[model samples]
Target: VTLPPKIVPRINICSWTYSPPHTHTHTNPLFPSDATLEMSNLYAEQKGKTLNLTEDELLTFYGILLISGYNSVPRRRLLWSDDYDVSNTAVKDAMRRNRFDEIMSSVHLVDNMKMTADPFFKVRPLFKHMDDINKTIPIAEHVAAWCKQFIRGKPIRFGYKIWSLASSSGFVHQMEPYVGSHTHLVETGLGQGPSVILGLAEKAEVPPSAFKFYHGNLFTTLSLVDEMTLRGDGSCGTMRQTQLHNVPFTAPKTFKKTPRGDAEYLVEVEKLIVRWTDNSVVTVVSNMEREFTETEAKRWNKQKRTMDKVRQPKCIQDYNTHMGGVDLHDQFVSRNRVNIRSKKWWWPCFNWALNSKDLLSFQRLVAQTLLLRHGTKPSRQGRRSSMAVAITDATRFDSFNHWPCNTGSRYKRCKNCGGRTSFACGKCDVPLHVECFKKDHTE
Candidate 1:
């Protein structure tokens, strides 16, 4: 049951900040007056009555998902020169070709002390300098951990992908005392978010799924759909041809405004999600005047009590400020592409599938597998072991849950021969034998 060291050492940490609240325009969503100073301006352009965030403003939301423990793909990331060099396009290509598991990070657990903690958020950063930092945990430990969840106990294949996402200036290091009885893999992100979920399906047995998102005013929906369709209650040929699946959930027509400049409206929709079954109906529902009452806040607070055991500290001290999880992802982890976009507006409109939140929704909307932890590069034979990994090689029985090689680490991959090749012989009675695998693949 030996496991590999993580590739990224520092625990995945996302950094963030938030807006103090104020009076929201009818078009904007609600937040406490003390939540942020930027709330008013952001609210001014809250374009439709629905869709809380456009793609541009997704970083704020991405911060939220990071705290929720989902490896939502960030639009931007902080990739180190080393990570890019070692993982190289070829290694990633190979890992993707051998995807083994589809699960991302687990949901954030609750704790008893009301501390609102998750494992990575709890560990304090003690390193005075980056070079003298712990290498194995950040680099090999975290990556190896993520890999263990995905590839454990699966046979390798080609054309699979492995991904990591977070929202902080994180770090990874080579394992301590480089030579030891146990080998640890490692990986860490300076800032991480859901960057890893984009290609999960190509390598996963259980790939990501999508949820139908219904946002914006009902009138907006009506107009958009009406513009493309002349008929009622059926798929519009134009929309279908364009691959847009928006269909009516309530009234087929638009909502009319009342004298008060306010109108009662709603938008209903269906999305595709997966659990243990297929194509689950994710009927997302919300209404106007939406606010989290004390009861809902209390519910969240109670869950906070249970998840305290998991929180840890940020790897980078300079980027330590955080306010809820998504806030961190928004400010630090998400990558911002160079833009020649319009600047007529007072501010930058971060619209696109590039922000952490939008990408997160993309992952969930499309059912992308998420990574909870980073990874390790340790192999049973050596680093990045691909021995006996050819098409003809026998499947290994212990790929799924090998013993922690050291430093409380393990490895998993999502690139495998579907779920057909169970690495752990006992988990399911797959015919692949461990001895046969070791004999042929041992380096």
Candidate 2:
């Protein structure tokens, strides 16, 4: 896949210093003591509770909470009540004041402010400097290597065998060089240039084998078509001519109109063009060995009292199935995102780290839950249970508790023992006889 040569400019890096607000000399009622004093006292008092936790274990816990969906430390404190003996106000004060070192010290977290020490912490420097052509290949290789190292305990193939790279317009340029040979790249929005494609193939360490490119109809530029035909890349001339004539350079009003069914139209050739119900046309270019195939999707035809078969392009179908992982991840991050609104330029990077932490925690939780439900060890040789079972089990037994009945004059028998009573179990919110309450709770 040879594309035109065009240089994308690299972003210039700048340095900045962060200094705490000038509140050290002033006495604030909310924060009574200095961070160091407060943290020391907190550690002395709560040391017994967290004595069992190692430094790494404590750091992991803090990392999870910091990146958790809870917007503030107070909310996080509520969840950690069972484990940590820290007050909500204390947690809030430490975070709000930006006392990272003090908090770490209090929790006995090692590395002494390692989380906050780096100004460019959690920023992807690769993306920022990718436009520097000289740096692109090295950065991609480094990132791929890092990914291979950081991810452990399971084979990468078990998760995503086919890496699907999809991003908003200009963003894809930075990522193209790293896309694996078997990867499917989906470029959304317009303004895709030939240089991006050629640069990816030329620079990326990943070989150009069975790579598929899925883009919006607008991305199928006239130059791209010319390049394909000129290279004699097995593209049908007539089909190319038809596509050049039929597919508008700009999106049409018709394309903007939403369809009621699976897709408005589907055209399959060496390349596939699918106009989906969402009023978007997707163009896919594939070099896979398999022939282009269409699957039948049945929709209920109320007027005809029958099921109507809808033809869906294999490319579109595959895109729909695999493209959702990224969206799902974004949804998870957005739903439980930390609320950090800062004027500091590095805040975005910091926020990204927090989101990453949340994502890691979410993934771990899901994996653990799945492991428990399946009762299987994490290993390549482990046999999976074929039978489908519920991920969680429902409560099997019921117990009675004592509570005061809200209904003053309403006459009813006790739910537990069938005896009339004015009081109810507040915990269970069930009416109970005084005699039955003792026996129900005891036994």
Candidate 3:
């Protein structure tokens, strides 16, 4: 594939020249809000600069550019490279269209709990517009066609964090056939904190009931399986790790005997296919920097040790096993600190206390950010976010609080109570009450 010439040149220019001030006036609006994002670039400062990206020696720069996007502290900041840069021309376009600034400003406003439009701006139009409906159905059919046409009929995996990635649902819905129609659907990339483990437990890509959640901190999920087997036999005797219902845990039926027959690894196999990993194992957050503040970071590391300690017993009692110290990746590695006090190896910073309450609270924070990026909602002070999508007062959406609490969020409408909620079962923390949950469904 041919590379974009400006991609290399533009990135290098920005990394070297752009060092944003640590504390800028938040109200100054560094970039304007009234620009169109799709048609603009944010850079014009490097007009005369010449950067060659078509050289063989420069090919390595593309890999670097891509990895930098992954390794950067926040993962959002762009990096410089010898080649394959996004030009200042692009930045200028972004600013002129007010796209980048608007997106960022929208994220910022939502994090602060500001309203952005009625929250369901697109959703309302989505339901009403036949053209929009026409656009939605074919993507999934195309995905299935592409897979069958190219891959010679193999199972496929589809994924999205239903709660946090509500915007992605359209694409997923379009691609729904590839997921629901007998493909090896795999999904992951849950949040990085305690939610990481809970995400695993919820089994977003997989069914929550299919697997058990163990408090035991195995060297990895593989090690956990090794311990779960019957004495010298290959039987998967029943024992619960992370519990949902009274489901029996079974060993790999056809899968556990392959060369690297680790059933624990099955969940990621779907990811390998979707991301073009070609059925090979690849690492995402492999070499982490573990950076954090001195005083607070230490406290977090210590608490993790305590949680690790607590989890160790459950792991051992259930599966006649033992392990060394807990691993950060197993639980969480602080940016760069050690948790010396966590009775469990996996105590997280925020939701380590209560999964029920804290999970919703943190997710709410994330949802607010999403609202600002995609809506016409104004903040409390009426300082409109740049990414705000304008909808008339006649148009309204479910509040940010009404977002689905989990990946399988179903909009529900209450019958008797005339309320709208997201949970079909009237489950608490589903982002709406039973009345609203059911009402939304009926309406």
Window of ten residues with lowest summed lDDT in model 3: 9-18
Top candidate when judged by lDDT against the true structure: 2
Which stretches of model 2 miss by more than 4 angstroms? 1-67, 70-98, 101-204, 222-292, 298-308, 357-443
On the 0 to 100 scale, the lDDT of residue 395 in model 1 is: 36
Residues 1-443 of candidate 3 have per-residue lDDT tens digits of: 22111100000000000000122110100111122121112211123322222222121211222222223322222221111233122212112222222232221111113334443221222222322232333221100001112233446443211111011111111111121222212333321222323332222232222232222211123222332221121111122133212222222232223222111211121111000010121111100111111110011125345422111111112222211111211122223221112232122211111111112233334333333332232122223322232331112233333433433544554434645544433222334554355454334
Q: Write the number of the candidate with greater lDDT, choosing between 1 and 2.
A: 2
Q: What TM-score would candidate 2 get against the native?
A: 0.37
CA lDDT of every candidate: 0.21, 0.34, 0.22
Q: Could you give the C-alpha RMSD of every candidate to the true structure, in order shown?
A: 29.7, 19.6, 28.6
- Candidate 3: C-alpha lDDT: 0.22
lDDT of 2 by residue, 1-443 (tens): 32222211100001000011111111101111233233434454565332232333333334344434453445333322322333333233223222333333343212233445333332323223332332232211101100111245655433211111222110111232223432223342323334334334344332332233332232244455345434433211111223444443224355345343333222323333334332233334332213545665566777899977666555445544333322343354466565434454544333433343224455445323322342322223222222211111111123433445455534667877787767676665567776676665555
CA lDDT for candidate 1? 0.21
